[model samples]
Target: MDKKRIILNIVVVCLILFSLYILQNLLMPKYVSAIVEGSLIEEYYNEKADYNHDIIFIGDCEVYESFSPISLWKNYGITSYIRGSAQQLIWQSYYLLEETLKYETPEIVVFNVLAMQYNEPQKEAYNRLTLDGMRMSASKIRAVKASMMEDERLIDYIFPILRYHSRWNELTSEDFKYVFKKDKLFHNGYYMRVDVKPVTSIPRGRKLANYQFGDTAYLYLDKITKLCKDNGIELVLVKVPSIYPVWYDQWEQQIEDYASKNDLLYINFLELIDEVGIDYSKDTYDAGLHMNLTGAEKLSLYLGDVLTKTYDLTDKRTNKEYQEIWQEKIDFYEQMKAQQYYELEKYGYLKSFGAKAPED
Candidate 1:
């Protein structure tokens, strides 16, 4: 071919590739300003793990919103991270745990038992919120396959631009600002809420024809249990004390039986509300659906005692390296705490840090 023709072709190809890249970037959702739970998984990759975590918590909002890793560090000297998202499913939690072990195997793995109620994929939105942040790998591929709803397409996940192409017209300033990067929104995967919305009443769970957890749920539970055993990672199963959605006696019995069978520690925090010092009136941000900062810290303190006492875990408080690393987290935690209080005082509600405010 002629020199001019070859040069023209190269320029055209470069233009096409660059255009695709920009279009893809513009079309993607920026979870920074809203629905910030979507950013939790991706944030872990961005985290500088100067010190390894002793515990890795995996589950849905229950695990992320109900526990404070900073509280664990500050009070118990226990290093931990929660790899959780909105409505994270059993298989997704399993895959997240599998992927997490590839990075650093914690001394203990805490799997929130709440996800056990879901036998299959619940919502595509939840799936996206949980799966979109994951870096591509075999685990991600399996999770995508396992978690995809009937209407969802696999190709859309492979190239998110295809799924989000319609988002072009709905683009906000957040989409552009965070197109290449995101702001730090969490402290070691713990979503913080300083505001309080006390629980007024506790409702009983409606009776069902069947209380047996589905085969798929049990299947993944077994997988999670075996995975922990094979890796020499102690797995602690806990039913986070979220006061809404009645956890049935039958469900409790099943998990208790499974824990007993596997020789694992299972603590139903719902039963120990008074011991944990969780005052639903002041500890929860959204009534009883989730805990706020005070509740989380209270629960963390109790659990930290249990973990430190039961296991041969390290107290990294005296380690200078850990002190330096955690000091940065502590600084961010205090700053965000102040910002949340400021927003609450000015707006009568939290205006930033992921939750809704007065206007936006």
Candidate 2:
């Protein structure tokens, strides 16, 4: 074949391969290899047909682990969804909300307050990964404002590929499945057991972490808060429980102070440990920050009750579809409880690891 014909054949072959890859992604069952969190993107795209939630929770893993939208549905008949990541910062959050606003508008927005610590004058490579994977608006103005003094901010928010380029190679078939699971995904939210340990002593001293509130962080926070206020939405700041002695000592007072100044209702569960029934030794998942399934459930129950009382959220459980969704979550919780109990008992490491055996 002549050179032109040869080049044309190669081009045709490449286009065919690209088409096949796209088709594979669209046809594969979700739960194969796609990252679990990417499912949120999938859900967002399909939300117009399936979703009708009254509340939306956004932030990092703290929001995912702490808030159980399913529990809210079960107890108060409110439907909600969590659009959070493992390490989402405020700038990404602003864009995430911006993108979400395109599809749905809930009555309330619960932003996990942990993003406050992500305040940096400049954006880092980490911020880019979140920005790319979540697909936030790459506005130069927003990026400049977010990174006040840091040059890295613009690239991180605009070109997230710089941060998550490695993820391309690490993508496995299972990640594809997770991303495109064919099964109907429900907004079951997270659930964990409550720690029943009694409060023995209070830690001393209150020192804040060197969490620098950069102009960008505050600007986005103010913008988010104002957006909520303008839309007639209620904004709540929540500090999910943690076992780090220093985390509690350093952040408790500072967060409380921020909440007071912003006129936001700050629910510091660290201060209400007794009320929340948190057993640091038992409820913590990593013996550090964040809670496990058991801990998530307990906190969900408490927070669900608190939210019900504080907000005028409506209940949608009467609908047949919602009932089906709640039933699925109930079954999932039952399986989780059984699995956790089995693991705890079989290892004999539960007690040593601070997990108390369930009392009969």
Q: What C-alpha lDDT do the candidate models reach, one value each?
A: 0.91, 0.61
- Please give the distance, in angstroms, between residue 185's alpha carbon in candidate 1 and its true position after superposition: 0.3
- Candidate 1 clashes between residue pairs 3 or more apart in a chain or in different chains: none
lDDT of 1 by residue, 135-169 (tens): 98899999999999999988888888899999888
Q: lDDT tens string, model 2, 112-137?
A: 77677656633343443344344344
Lowest lDDT block of 10, candidate 2: 26-35
Off by over 4 Å in 2: 1-51, 121-129, 135-212, 245-254, 336-360
The TM-score values for the models, in the order shown, are 0.95, 0.69
